[model samples]
Target: MALPAASVQLYSLAKEFTADPQGSLDRLAAIGLKNVEAFDFVRRPAEIRSALDASGLVSPTGHAPLLTDELWTPDGSIPTPAPEVVFEAAAAIGIQTVIDPFVAPERWLTEEGVADIAERLNSAAEKAATFGLNVGYHNHAQEFVASFGDHTAYERFVSLTDERVQLELDLFWALTGGQDVPALVSRLGDRLTAVHVKDGIVPASNPWAPGAEAFGSDSLDQRHAGTGEVPLAAALRAGSAIQYAVIEYDRAPGDVFADIEASLGFLREGGFVA
Candidate 1:
């Protein structure tokens, strides 16, 4: 099969997007992107749909909260809407997968907490299926904080959840969690449906902490793709089942659009995305 289309997480340019969602997308289109991983689209499906139609880009996947009471971000949080409402909005906007971008760090600390996270998502997945939408989870480094036997909380959650609950691994965060990133991708197999392709120089004293620092830099230095310490090529080589290689950054290293273009070049030239 052809590799999945390259995508850019809109959150990588969250500020510019919030200011001009249409303009931000226009820039992406100019960069040759055909897909995007949307954030904060639950409350404005019609508006987003219109914008997407105008831009000629499709958002097959998007981020919204299904487990939490509120969706948190560095900018702010949006109150979590009912799953039925979320599904309705997603359907209206032509989203195929509704991946919960985050759950609190503490939720991954204990076996019981991880179990609840899985159970709740499994229930959500069942509900989402009714709308012809798939549910998934995106990881931050925090999920690796606590270990349950040989596996971490993330792995345990993987075991507890139904197979339909897809995964979108953030490669940079996985590295921050001190994981052998490529090996983890191979191990995840078909369950891994997407990856947030990122690069950065990780700090020396990294630890498996129970919070969002593992998601991105607390003190690490961000870099353009292929220039950072992350073995992005190796990780992508292992993602045999990955559907969307989303270019992202918690804090952009330079001219955001130019930075994204560089990563896109890396993915395309390296044949990581079709």
Candidate 2:
């Protein structure tokens, strides 16, 4: 099956990116990648954009917080700016989609909380249009912690959001949350604009469930694409409209760039990308 353009989420090499943005991007470009996913860039769009221009890399999708007071990552938290400010920066950096990468686990367990997320994203999506941008959400295992009726909080949130508010499901996290990864991807249909093309063994325990609030990521042994538990090929085949097959790692199993190259090779060998 024909696949989306292959890209790497910059967060996969956060240390290298922070220490030497230009060198880091050049290194990825050397790996034969022309696209990358931006993370935590709402604060320094111009700086990042300059590097992208120099390196000839395009950031079509990025991570930012539009609904929450702050965004959290394994590294730390970033206070959010107004949605309009975010859109301006995203537009400046030439990002087509600004995807909120995480929301706390506590927020996904209730009806009111899920609606609030959908409402905020829908409002943001409307504002994003003026900037020639799209808004989306990226999932972690927490999104599946609670089920309303027969569906997960993740599914409920998807149903509530406007179609313009899209999704980027993290496959490894979905498996970590005890989901049938490929089936879930298909269920999302065309709303999935991109997916965190993660491949890792699901931990023996689903630690991000509602009560397990102090979830940790150390247990996740993320491997190269197609080498772990996630059914990446099946899932990729299901996303008919996916625009980017983004490689990522919450924690690198080894040298980060080498791991990225390995995933890119998997994409090529699987014919998941050109």
Candidate 3:
């Protein structure tokens, strides 16, 4: 199937965005990006909107860090608007979804805990609905690893969250968690609002397998989309029903722009997207 015009997560280039938001957006736009998924804890919606407009890109969704105790801490918080403010911003930006990228550490386990998180998400979804936007949870490997004995915490979330709540599956993380991306997508169906398109490989060197980097540098775990071990084409096929597929790389080997450009080339020519 031919892929739609692609969008990228701005956080992947946080260094550049921080140094020069306007220049970074322009550079990305020049690289053929029609849309962007921005992440800035300090920048307001108005500031983002102005920058995006200047760069000739639109944001159909925003990365709203999930509400958790960790977010109350310094390093994890994103400047989320108040519910009313978020609604107003969504209305102005034409954003349909707000993706919460990480579950707070304290909130990642147990049936009751999962239920509590679901209730919170459901409430957010409800509030967002009033603004014509939806709330979604974005996953990481932790979600897949944190399990309730038999089922993974991710499974718990999927099973418990209200139908209105959506998911933004990160295919690479799904594989890292040892879950079947296609199966999960099939199960979730329309509940999947968007996806993060990237690739991962079974590490041959295993940087962190035994005695590796002092802090365990397993950078090989993540690679540019379509260039690693993940079955990206298959994943994309499964997400055909989704509304958006945003390209991302948590760590770029060298140039962030080059990584994104190469991934885009692969996505367009490798049959994941047109």
Top candidate, metric TM-score:
2
| Model 2 agreement with the true structure over 1-274: per-residue lDDT tens digits | 3468999999999899999999999999999999999988988999999999999999999998887898777657789999999999999999999999888888898999999989989999999999999999999888888899999999999999999888998988898888898899889988988988888877776666645535445656889999998999998988877888999998889999999999999999989986
The estimated TM-scores of all candidates read: 0.94, 0.96, 0.85
Query: Using lDDT as the measure, which candidate wins?
Result: 2
lDDT of each: 0.88, 0.89, 0.72
lDDT, candidate 1, 1-274, per-residue tens = 4587899998899889889889989999999999998888887899888888899999999999999999876556789989999999999999999999888877888899999999999999999999999999998777887899999889999999999999999888888777899999999999999999989887564334533244333345888889898889998888778899999988888889999999999999998898
Give per-model CA RMSD. Answer: 2.1, 1.3, 3.9
Give the Å shift of residue 59 in candidate 2. Answer: 0.1
Better of 2 and 3 by lDDT: 2
Candidate 3 displacement at residue 70 in angstroms: 4.2
Ranked candidates, highest TM-score first? 2, 1, 3
Candidate 1 regions with alpha-carbon error over 4 angstroms: 205-220
Candidate scoring better on TM-score of 1 and 2: 2
lDDT of 2 at 134: 96
